[model samples]
Target: MKKSLFSKVLFVCLIIPSVLTQAAEVNVYSYRQPFLVEPLFNVFTEKTGVKVNVVFAKKGMAERLAREGQHSPADILLTTDISRLVELHDKDLLQAVDSETLEKAVPEKFQSKDNTWYGLTMRVRNIYSSKRLGQVDLSYEDLADPKYKGRVCTRSGKHPYNVALVSSMIAAHGEEKTLTWLENLKKNLARKPQGSDRGQVQAIHQNLCDLSLGNSYYFGNMLNDEKQKVWADAVNINFPNQANRGAHVNISGVAMAKHAPNAKNALALMEFLVSEQAQQMYAETNMEYPVREGVAVSALVSSWGQFKADELSLETIAQHRKAAIKLLDKAQFDL
Candidate 1:
């Protein structure tokens, strides 16, 4: 009887731990690449003892989340780009959580109006110019200069970054003036806007275009690649519109699924992410700026120097997105 009671107690101890482990697990579906977001997950699991199950897809996370609905097992949604985040909110797939931590870490412009989503990291649309040249002129309007005609390269205008940049112009000017700018800008492209932003930098090395518009991180990432390093090394990265409203910027952020299976765990993870440790990892690894104040920018990013970012509430950017996209379509900015 003594041995029997001892065995039963031991069994209970083992099974209880397993049950508790299962209870703490959070299932996440992320639009960000695995490498980009998994580190944050690992850190969260380490700190909270919550196990994470992740499903990574390059696109269609929104549709998948919608299809899953209340039956969905996803407790968290992590993605890049504002449009998709806005889409999920519009679809009613996100739930608002009252986290004072998130509010303190993220700015009002970088989060959803209802707190359904929150921005984690920020990036800028910047100009890359030749260092061999005299003084660098940093202005978005410089692309329209006749000297830059046939010397400008960029990624797809249909891309969200470009769309946001164009949207900023539309906000500053108006639809008619923004359309004319794009029309002339497209005519001046050295070659058609093709390939990724990195491709635009490569065009700079090849002398295909004297100036290119691309994400700030691409410049840092290229510093590690052999062939690409040549392109990145030869150029000077500049933040345009410094004396004016500054460069166009966007953010990569997160939200909790409306029917989070592990709502508590999801909130804990969000809190951990905005913490300084995770924000540092986010900035150093991704070459992005932490949304929180006083976290130093990455060395690579800082080297490019600081410039103003359009202070338009990011929500305004999202609000104008549909109109901006319509203008792009009308301007025939396909290339």
Candidate 2:
């Protein structure tokens, strides 16, 4: 009986460590597309020996996390746009992180003041005008001018991208001025606000409009596709507000879940992402500017001349989001 008991105890001991190793994994709820982030995670796994498990969704991961509450299995949340990141933080779904590596890598302006989130990449909001338009220089304010009436194309004002831009306008100007600007911009739309940023580019190609607003990376993505390359070729990217506060910019960022079960692995992955090697891979793969200083942008991205990014803190811009949305509705922007 004693011999049998010893063998069973030995088996249990062997199984337990393997189970613990498997449990060392980090779980990610990501709004970013899988292709954009999987390569970085693979490298993280190879370096740290801690596995990454990602669940991707196009939307509502934040709500899902909130619903999951303290019992949530999510260790980290990866998403694009400052709006979504701020939304997660505002919902109390994210926890503050204290990582010296992240602090050193990311700029103060690009990270949460409370350290709940950090930006991974920078994407400029640029105006794409038909090459036929011939060297038109414009600012965000100029979009509302009567001269450009009926020449603008954009995605829905309700989209997080547009909302963030509108929020910035509210920050630079104010509620009343922003509201008036929205009304004028609404009048300037060639058609009802519709489509993705790429779709707006397509509109410019079709001569439906002479100008559109889009993130810089979408142009790079389009250039990679044979069919879409023609649309990309048709427009010249213009960095708006070069003379003033600088062009509006946004980020793709990540946060830790408030009740992360694998906090150590999650923090490790977060730190790894901001490291020089990972930032380079991130910039090259996504065709975005790395948030970490001195990590070079992709060669293709470099071909586009650099312009000053707006210096406004994202937290200040986030505060105006509600006001921006209200202004959009009041202007009947999407309607």
Candidate 3:
């Protein structure tokens, strides 16, 4: 009897650790860069004793997830831009999350109707003008005014950032009007749309154009970088259409993988992400607006001051993306 009891005790000890080890780690497939998320993940691991395993990729996450199917080890998907999140949703790659924490912290407009995803941070699609031009007050509609012809610059119209902006336009104004705006806005371009958002700031600095469109976080990002500061300094960040619908906004968000092996841990991490501790940390890390209300933005972001964000639902914006792309093609905006 003593020998049998000893064997049973030994088996219990071995299995407990095996189960604990399996339960303590969660895997993630992130489109967000390591530098942007490493601190948050490190803190989470320290607090919860759950290891985070990550695979970083610039693109093709959907295809990979589809290929992996049920065998995929990914418990969570972290990515920037609503377009990517919507893509994953459309592909049925992510599972719905029904967390009271997320629902309470993330505004309804920033999350999916069914809660498949939730925004972690927000950024505005801002219109930037040259200081040489003085403090110019304008709206998105003003970009197409003949008065500003040959004075505007932007990245490609088809880029996801711009696509979302165009979609917002469609939501605000019907398709016909938006298509006309696109054509006129194209006519106003100082040059063919090309390059990244920062490149548009560079163009403003070089006097290529007096006005351009860019994401608000790029202002903070540029100010932090020694070389880019000059380009940032050359322009003033303007939140367009404060008088109307407010500035267009987008998000960096997260979703649970459909076949998450460590689902419970993923849910815990998801809840932690919306907690004030993680919200403030993540906002500071990315130089973005926290999705959680009442969280203070980083000092630099605060310096930019606050503006009313257009409260349009992101799901509505996602619904209009196809039409926005069609308008871009119709106008030959990039050409």
Against the true structure, what is each candidate's TM-score? Answer: 0.91, 0.95, 0.95
Per-residue accuracy of model 1 over 213-258 as CA lDDT, tens digit each: 9888888889968878999987888888888887788888899999
TM-score of 3: 0.95
Tens-digit lDDT string for candidate 3 (267-321): 9998888889889998897789999989999999999888989989999998999
**What is the RMSD, in Å, between candidate 3 and the native fold over all Cα?**
2.3
Candidate with more favorable, higher lDDT: 1 or 3: 3
Model 2 C-alpha RMSD to native: 2.6
lDDT of 3: 0.94
lDDT, each prediction: 0.85, 0.92, 0.94
Better of 1 and 2 by TM-score: 2
Q: Which window of ten consecutive residues has the lowest lDDT sum in model 3?
A: 31-40
Which 10 successive residues of model 2 have the least lDDT summed? 17-26
Candidate 2: where is the Cα deviation over 4 Å? 1-19
